[model samples]
Target: MDISIREGILTPDTFAGLRAACGMPELETALVGRAIESSLFTLSAVNGSRTVGMVRVVGDGAFVFLIYDLLVVPLWRRRGIGSRLVEEAVSRAKLFVPPGRAVVVSLFSAEGREGFYSRLGFTELPAAGLGAGMQCFYL
Candidate 1:
């Protein structure tokens, strides 16, 4: 299959479908639309016209970027689509910072998925003397 990764062409419906296929809870269509519009970068993996994978980056556009909502349809999982999406997203996020300046690109890997990101050069926190990463989610 020829999977083509494109930027900024994701629709709410496609986003929701990809989310569902990855076992995530359904989100409101309006919320998906707003999130897509606000994301710093968004990439969708397409096989012909179907969206089989996606990833989003959110950040301040200068110093910090957090990758979020990376998902690929189950049938497509072992084919390197997720890795490609992440590589592209990180590449674009780095462009937001000026040369010689440092930028942090981070993500919270889903449980049991840390190895996937690690292979792509992400280090888990609490190593290297840094504290464990923390988060507070809205209930």
Candidate 2:
């Protein structure tokens, strides 16, 4: 398959397809649609005319960067697309942070995927990051 990565908002038709492909829970389209327009960085992998994979990075453009919505279609899952999406996000993160304190990149992965991220060089934070926050509510 010929896969090309493009930068743009996720189209409405591809929204459900992409969400299901990535195994993400359903979200309101309007909310997601609004985000697509405001996203600072987004990469989509397309095969011919089909969107096969995608990932987005949403943040304040300076202090905080969060990785979100990474999903490769089920048919394309094991072909290193997921990791490529992550690599792209990391590369974008580099563009956001300068040489001073530290850039914090965080995400909440699904149940069995923590090991997958650890394999990708993400580790459990003992402190100073994930450990520094207190949650009021979770959905």
Candidate 3:
């Protein structure tokens, strides 16, 4: 099978479908479109005309980059598509850093998926001289 990765070509429908295929709840179409348009970068993997995977980078475009919504359809998991998406996002993040300075590229890994990101060099926070990462969601 051939997979092509394209940047900044995701539609809300495709994004929602990919999210659903990955067992995530549906998001509002307007919100998804707004998020995509506002993201630092967005990448989608296409198998012909269907979107099989997607990943996005969100941040202030210099100091911090957070990998968000990394998802690959169930049928495409275990095939490295997700890894490739992350690699592309990381590459973009590096470009945002200015010379003689550093930028943080981080993500909140889905539970039980630490190995996936760790293999790509992401470390668990608060474990290597860093503070614990925290978040709060309003329900």
lDDT of 1 by residue, 1-139 (tens): 7999999998899999888888889998899999999999899999998899999998889877999999999999899999999999988887888876767899999999999999999998879877898988797
Q: Which pairs of residues have clashing backbones in candidate 2?
A: none
Using all chains and alpha carbons, the TM-scores for the candidates as numbered come to 0.94, 0.81, 0.93
Candidate 1 at residue 12, lDDT?
A: 93
Q: Which candidate do you rate higher for TM-score, 1 or 2?
A: 1
Q: Model 1: C-alpha RMSD to truth?
A: 1.3
C-alpha local distance difference test of each model? 0.91, 0.77, 0.90
Instruction: Report the C-alpha lDDT of model 3 over 19-88, residue by residue, as the tens digit.
Output: 8888889888999999999999999999998889999999999777999999999999899999999998
TM-score of 1: 0.94
Ranked candidates (TM-score, high to low): 1, 3, 2
Ranking by lDDT: 1, 3, 2
- Candidate 1 vs 2: which has more lDDT: 1
Separate clash counts for every candidate: 0, 0, 0
Q: Which residue pairs in candidate 3 collide? A: none
Scored by TM-score, the top model is: 1
Report how far off residue 27 is in candidate 2 (Å): 3.1
